[model samples]
Target: MKSEDIQIRDPFVLPIPEEGKYYLFGSTDRNIWGPGTGFDAYVSADLAEWAGPFPVFRPPADFFADTNFWAPEVYARGGRYYMFATFRRKDNDLLGTAVLAADQPLGPFLPHSGGPVTPESWSSLDGSLFEDEAGEPWMAFCHEWQQIGDGEVCAVRLGADLREATGEPVTLFRASEAPWATPYVSPRYPDTANYVTDGPYLFRGDSGALYMLWASFIDNTYALGVARSASGGIAGPWHHQPEALYRNDGGHGMVFRAFDGRLLLTIHAPNRTPDERPLFLEIEERDGRIALAGRTSE
Candidate 1:
């Protein structure tokens, strides 16, 4: 679809080879009025034009929170599709990530777990699941900076069934530790700087180099940054890249391969809350690092 035609943030596309179609999903908000009715998916053979805004998920009648249903990422694993998404609780004013399951990419996904994965007391969101080499699942999530001055990315082991977290979440890295990460600047906090980390995507390269693409703001512009797992595993001794993967006013990136064997990085740029659209960029790996090879719109 044309970039302007699709209204979404945190754009996620899943290619179904069997159906010969690609499904695109994201957070769709008409305006600042309130949360969108539900999550929708669009199908396409080519990325330029889309078919339908098919409803994949909607809040249940007894759903907890109506607002702040954000960042839905669908992953196909072990014959089922699982969605990791964030929701805000009405009672406590806390945000947490929860898992939902369905049989297909465009799903009528329903909650699979009993409740939120992050602890009830702490404010967390944007939870992404990563499976390590040993086939054990792990959740890489963000601890919101609003609750704490410095936002943190953490990892915790997922239960064998992928329904719950097994132990206390371990701190992987703080947003401020990365050279490319910048803090949220506001007149409210004139003296103190608070870092914000949103979205964490983990993928292992064909060459066996482990990499993660995450989002943060830099100099008031949304940007994407990368970090490498030096131990060649998801549970890293990760090394932050000296430079970010993309620094334009865009972020929240994910990597997927085209049918033609080319690696592509998909992210939205010019990221304003009400004006974000999907953009795809060709990518290549060199010297154990990934970089933008070309822009599709070029």
Candidate 2:
């Protein structure tokens, strides 16, 4: 499929320098809000025309989740590829992030972390992997505002094997804290002015600063923003930028360095189904934060 033809959300790109290819993964279900089939991926050598709807993960018969499969991100560790994704339970309808495994960057990934590493009681999603300066693995995810009035981005230390959580999740920040975040007006919950926090991704700036990219609403449009870790670590007194980085109808973004070493930010635009397509924008790490430089042709 051509890069623009794929209908996907929460777009994530994993570049393999050795393979001379980039693997694209994300929420691949036809209608992600309902029942889900599984996740698919596409590969590109030049990020232009691509080749796949590769089945990277199809759940086994007895898999715990059967709906709302979303945002699958792959990371290389210990000579293996691990996929962190979010799923909703069939039994209780609870949402959480779970770990999956595969041998190659693309594979028929199988469940690895038993189930979710997030707390079973909390509604969470969009788990992305981050290795701390000391090499401690952590999953930064969102605690859904459906459970709490203010949605939050939280981080939990993961076990060395990346199979489970080793400690309680620490709340990094709430959606309302972002100056540009607007209250989500949902008809389902009429009386509440709840805010949303989605897709928490952590990365180190060129100046050795810790930065987090997350999404929320600004004037009811899905927008992505940046927050710098004041302490230069995950356990931070994080400070939000004065405004959003990209306020267009696009969000749930993650950053990857391209084959030529240009920094690219990937996110699905329009924030709507079927029409949503992966949008890649050029970004650069300034003194301690990221700024949009331009849009990528591919």
Candidate 3:
């Protein structure tokens, strides 16, 4: 499949060294006409030609299907690949993040836990995992502004089994708290400043500086930014830089090393609501910070 042939938001690619191929996963929809369905995974060897839309996951028989299925990211850990994704519940009108497990990257994934890592009562989404220096697991997720008014990013310790939350989730920062984040003002909510919090992925810099790449709107345009953890840990006093990492109305980014050992960031640019394409850019670490090195044709 060509890049435009694949319709997805928050595209994540996991390169399997043993197979010499990449597994791609994201939201696959029929049209921009209704709520999102489940996700699909595709395999590619050269990042140009794709092989399978191999059914990685779909709503189970009689499963909750009306609400959105958004931002599915796969991570390989401890001999198993795990998928962290966002799902909303129609029965209670609540949103949360859940974990799925599989033996392979392009998987017939199975729900490992009963539900989300965040509490059922909280309206949360975009949950991602991070491992600290001591090899401790942590989940950082967003508390939706639709329910809280000001969206927030929260973190909590994950149990060893990766099935349950070890403790309560702590508020890390609000969407409005970042110096670079702007409020979305539309006629829908005219009186107040509406905030949004989207994807959050953790990366430990080569210099041991911990950072987070998250998405939000700046002047109602989609953008991605990076924040540094002062303590070099997940539970830290994070400080947001004054500028965004990518500001092309695109976001929901993840950092990975290319097959050739160069650092790369993958995100969808020109972030139209329903139709978006995966874009990869070369990135470099300079002075313990990340920046756009260039764009790659690959």
Candidate 4:
């Protein structure tokens, strides 16, 4: 199948340089709000052509979460692959991120954590793994604006095994802190408006600068913004760029280096339910910040 034909959201690409393959995962269930199904991944040798709806993760019958299995990001660490994804239980309204394990990138991933690692009281999602220079693992996730009037991007230290939170979450920044982020008015609560913070992916530039790619609303449309950490760490005194990195109604993005050493940004475009498809754009670092080069021909 072609990438443009795949229906997905929160698009994350895991490029396996050794295998020369890319694995794509995201919020893929047909009815995202209903009982959750498992996650499916597509493999590609080139960014254009893809294969498989390979079932990388399927919850066991006794799994705690039955809906909102979202934003599964696979990372290779300590000789094993770990997945950081979000889930919500029917017994409770709170949604949080969890850690899963698999022997391979394209997995039969199984739950490795005790349960959702984010605070049970907080509504959080889109957890991405970040390992510090000291080799400590951390999770950077969004504290959803649905619960808080201004959504926040926060970080918590993860245990060595990648299964539990080792420290209290530190608020890195709020959606309102970003000059480019705009308020999104809730349809259900017309009088209430909130700033949104979605998908937080961390990147360490070749220049040794720390950067974060997070999604929010600009002009009431889904957009991706860039933030820089002056301290070169997760606990950042982050500064937001004046404008969005990508603002074409596509977001929930993650960046990966292609096999040929090209920096690529993967995101789901159109920002609409059921019609969203993965879109790839070639990106380059310019003046210590990310700039869109052009869409990848492949």
Candidate 5:
């Protein structure tokens, strides 16, 4: 199926240049807000034409989480492919990011990290893996706005095996920190003004500058925004750009270098269930800042 024909949320792409293919993964459940089955993936040589809904992950019968499976991002490390995803616990109504492992990009990824890597008490999601200058693994995730009035993007150092967090989570920034972010006025809490921060993906520029691609609201509309790290590192005095990269009811994006050496980005559009689809676009970096180059594959 083509990208337009597929329905997905929080879309993530893993490009294996050596295999000449790109594998796409995301929140694939029929109803992401409710119960979740597992996750699926699609493959493509060119970004437009895709191949399969390969079952990359099917939770075991004894799996800890049974709902809210979202944003599965795969990283090839130590000759193995590891998946960092969010799942909700059955016993308690809480969400956290867990680490799953597989032998290949598309595989029967099994629970490798025992269970949720983030703190069990916190409501977290959208775990993105980042390697620091010394090659230490870290998980960048969000402290849900639903839990805290001001949603926060936080990071925790992961064990080298990617199974557990070795340190306390450091709050990188709150959604309110970005000038472009607006308070999410939920009908459930009309008296409260809460800001949201989700999908913290890191990118390194040519000049060794570090930036983050994250999502929040702009005028009550979902949008994608960029922020730069003043210290050229993950743990930063991160500064937000004055404007959004894409603002039109679409967000939760990641950046990648296409096989042809072109910089590209992928995000789910419209931010509505059953209608959201992966959108690939060309992007350019100028002096460590990212701007929308334009849409590519539909």
Candidate 6:
């Protein structure tokens, strides 16, 4: 199937240099708010065409989470692969991120963290793995706006094995900190308007600057924004970009380099249920910031 034909959200692309292929993963279950089946990934030599909706993860019969499986990000480390994703249980409204592991990029990934690594009480999602200069692993995730009036992007220290959180989570920044992020008011709670923060992915620029790609609403439309770490680390005093990197009613983006060495940004477009499709845009880093070049050619 072509990438345009595949319906996915919170798009994540993992480039396997060894196999000369890219594996795409995201929120694939049709009923995202209800019970989730699992995660499916697509493989492609180029970004345009894909093959197989390979099942990378399937919850065991005794799984704790019965709904809301979202944002599966695959990271290769030390000859093994780890998947950071979000899941929630019907018994409790709280949502959190968990770690899953497998031997291959596309896999029957099994739970590695025992359960969600994020705090049991705090609502969170979109856990992304990053290793610092000292080679210590960290999980960057969103503290959802649903619980707090303002959503936040935070990081927690991960154990060497990447199965557990070793330290308390530190707030990197809030969604309202970005000039472009707008508040989303729930109709059910007319008096309470919340600023949303979602999908936090860290990228180190060629110039050695650390940037975070995160999602929120801008002018009532889903948008993607960039934040720079002033301290040049994940545990940063972050500076938000005045404008959004994308504001076309699409978001939850991540960056990856293609096999050809071109920098590409992938996001699910239209921001509507079932109709959403992964869109890849060519991007360039200039002045230690990110700028969209345009959509990749067919």
- Candidate 6 lDDT over 178-236, as tens digits, reads 99888886676668778999999999877889999999997678899999999999988
- Model 6 RMSD in angstroms: 2.2
lDDT of 5: 0.90
Per-residue alpha-carbon lDDT of candidate 1 for residues 91-181, written as tens digits (9 for 90 to 100): 6879888889999888899888776888789899889988887889999999998889898988888897778999999888899999988
Instruction: Give all candidates' CA lDDT scores.
Output: 0.83, 0.91, 0.81, 0.89, 0.90, 0.89
Question: Quick one: ranking by lDDT, best first?
Answer: 2, 5, 6, 4, 1, 3
TM-score of each: 0.94, 0.97, 0.93, 0.97, 0.97, 0.97
Q: Is candidate 1 or candidate 6 better by lDDT?
A: 6
> Candidate 5 on 1-298: residue-level lDDT in tens?
9999989999899999889999999999878998888999999999899998999999899999888899999999999999999999876788899999999899889999978999989999889999999999999999999999899999999999998999999999999989888998888888999998989999886677899999998878889999999988888999988888888889999988899998888999989888999999888777567887643112
Clashing pairs in 6: none
How many clashes does the backbone of model 3 have?
0
C-alpha lDDT of residue 149 in model 4: 86
For candidate 2, lDDT tens digit of each residue in 1-298? 7878999999899998989999999999989999889999999998878898898899999999989999999998999999999999776788999999989888879999989999999999999999988999999999999999899999999999999999999999999999989999887898899999999999876788899999999877889999999998998999998778888889999999998988888999989888899988889876566889843111
For model 4, residues 1-298, the per-residue Cα lDDT tens digits are 9987899989888888888888888889976767789999999999899998999999998887988889999998888889999999655878999999999888899999988999989999999999999989999999999898899999999989988998899999999999888889778656887999999999977688999999999878899988999899888899988889988898888889888888888998888888899998888777877778752111
Kindly give the stretch of ten consecutive residues in candidate 4 with the minimal lDDT sum. 289-298
Error of 5 at 240 (Å): 0.3
Give candidate 4's error at residue 43 in angstroms. 0.6
* Root-mean-square deviation of candidate 1: 2.2
- Candidate 5, residue 58: how far the Cα is off, in Å: 0.9
After superposition, which runs of candidate 6 have C-alpha atoms over 4 Å from their true positions? 294-298
Q: Which stretches of candidate 3 lie over 4 Å from their true place?
A: 31-33, 62-65, 294-298
